[model samples]
Target: MWTEGQDTCISLGVMVCVVLLTGMARVLVRRHTRSTFIRVFVAELLATFQLCCCSHELQVLNELRPDTPSWTLTVIYFLSLVHGLTLVGAVSNPCGVLEQLALEQMPVWLGFLKIFAQMFSSGLSRTFMVWVWSLGISSRHFAERSIKCASPIHIALPEAFLVEMLCSFIFHSTVMHFQEVRLKFRIHMQAALITFLVFAGGNLTGAIFNPALALSLHLQCFHELFYNYLIVYCLAPSLGIMLMVLMFIHFLPWLHNMNRIHKNE
Candidate 1:
């Protein structure tokens, strides 16, 4: 009863379903076991999304600006580096706190390092997604341009990037706090205020603090052969670097000293 085109649609839907279900299962397993499964799942999901978004953006750009090379590429690459560094630093904060607690330790330097690593890790998560998405988009483009008529898919890169950033805020803000609570870190109004400020600042810079989102959205929006490389390698990385610097300021020497004392004991 289904036509050929309809069959293709069904297949795509099925694939998306499978991915979501798999991700859910991984989340549940991690919740129960407290293993590294959560980390792996988060990484894989982020990477795949980024690559797909990037691929689509690349396709979209080719159609929009056929002439002068758009500087979008440069912006996106720089963003990626900044995103990677900041995210890794932020996310690693919980892990550092945990490590400190486990050893009955408290070191300001270690705490700072942990926070830095976590933030950078977050950006790296985005980078992974962007690359994964890009690979898919590229292969699809190659097939369409080379073998058959090019598929015309309308992509909204900026919107997609914003959505992903919102998700990051939700996950990072609440889940991170939960981690702190479980680790028995003193929860204070000041901590909450600081966390809120950080999230707001991050979102203000660009909803997509992660390089992966930037790359995916950029690729989806503009895929001009001439400009594509610039966006991926340059613009994305720059953003990551900037983000890294901002997030690094959160680490304090006193925090590291406290952890070190406990760790040494």
Candidate 2:
């Protein structure tokens, strides 16, 4: 369904290709440079690159085949797969990075840096996307872009908050559980899980559990007041990250012990 002539299609291809190639070149250079700052900064850029790429690609696919559940799911699945396959551990969502920190996968300070990078990347990506599409503050497309913000629509504030928490918990828990799996299969599982969750919860709250991505949307797409957006989209998911950590730590030992016992017996 993606033709070569449309401006949207051209922009999507050009931006993704350029961003990916740039990131790849940086990674290669960092291999020799081996600087911590460079590594983390590039990592942040790569992750944000994927994050914003996913956001825009989703819009393109949705528009191409709007209201078709299968098509949308397929689009999500492919995008998630691409994220997984890329050698870079591109975590475009700040909530995801927080979950990583909870699992002790990365250092605290670097996590903060990555969050900033991701936020900046999201804004940059959105700006580029708007330019490509000829969207501006007064454009109808600009107004329609509010979906990026993860702000409440028909749902009330409390319900929106609760929904985000639950979705984040589900997503984080799944990631932790599958953390040890081989890469070949892990991304597929994650992609499937994301597709399932998005289908179920996307309409409710845009199904974004990433605080950084939400921040990008808030700034660029003019989401609701900062207070409201922070409360429902960012804070709720942050709590969910902590809750997932606790649940994992408490249950993981028991599960390991049971596995050990079964093997010995």
Candidate 3:
């Protein structure tokens, strides 16, 4: 006869073991000079599996033991951060950082252009984030209105929002490093243009390009939680992307200066 607490403990233990093993695997895989696609695919698959397990376990625990305390929410917050960090770190293009550090080999104008492109990418990233959020909001609203034909549910849409923001930070920061490492054209003007188009397209399609947000929306649609598909898909990406851009812009100077010091030393 497994008690609720015992079951929860076992679940948590399994989650921890999975994470530790995944990290170890990542380290070992990184040491092997394998093909880029293989390494990336393996790393991303492992990381996603780890996060999915942890998130599923957490959601189950939250549901099974309703009326969670303050500390419980705090734990959820920490888990969310861990999930975001691991996911981004594992999948981020390894060469981006290397490119950013090699900016000294570039001309001043080229360096500025690189930074400018990053800013643009970061901005687009936020826009994409907001657009996803809007979609989630809109979908929920439309569904409820069509069914109940009344006002929208006044639910607080902050938890999923924060989770999405944290993930965006991890993603943009990792990409910024990759942009530095892999940038060849002095500026990612072409890539920037493509990103803009995709960002817009993602909004219209209701595909946030973010698994966590998608999960949150699913929870709402399936479990009677308040998830505004439109808001999630249309508005949240933009906000998240903008915030990331501001942080990266501030950090760009420090990154450049660090490279100079390293070279001199």
lDDT scores for all predictions?
0.39, 0.71, 0.45
Candidate 1 structure, TM-score to reference: 0.27
Per-residue lDDT, model 3, residue 246, is: 57
Q: Which structure among the candidates has the greatest lDDT? A: 2
Give a tens-digit lDDT track for model 1, residues 157-228. 444333434434443344434644532232333234333433443233323333433433344333453253
Candidate 1: deviation at residue 1, Å? 12
Residue-by-residue lDDT tens digits, candidate 3, 130-185: 34324433222122321222212233455445443444445455555565554344
C-alpha RMSD values across all candidates: 13.8, 4.9, 14.7
Residue 218 accuracy (lDDT) in model 1: 42
Identify the leading candidate in terms of TM-score.
Answer: 2
Q: Report the Cα lDDT for candidate 1.
A: 0.39
lDDT tens string, model 2, 1-265? 3342353455456446755775676668677777887777777776675667557646654565555778777767877787767635557778888878877889998888888888877777667656645543222234356445434334887898888899899988887788899988898899998899888887888787877666554553344476777788789999988888887786778799999999999
* Candidate 3, residue 71: how far the Cα is off, in Å: 3.8
- The C-alpha TM-scores of every prediction are 0.27, 0.79, 0.43
Q: Kindly report which residue stretches of model 1 are placed more than 4 angstroms away from their true locations once superposed.
A: 1-19, 31-33, 37-237, 240-265
Worst 10 residues of 3 by lDDT: 140-149
Give each model's clash number.
94, 0, 54
Greater TM-score among 1 and 2 belongs to 2
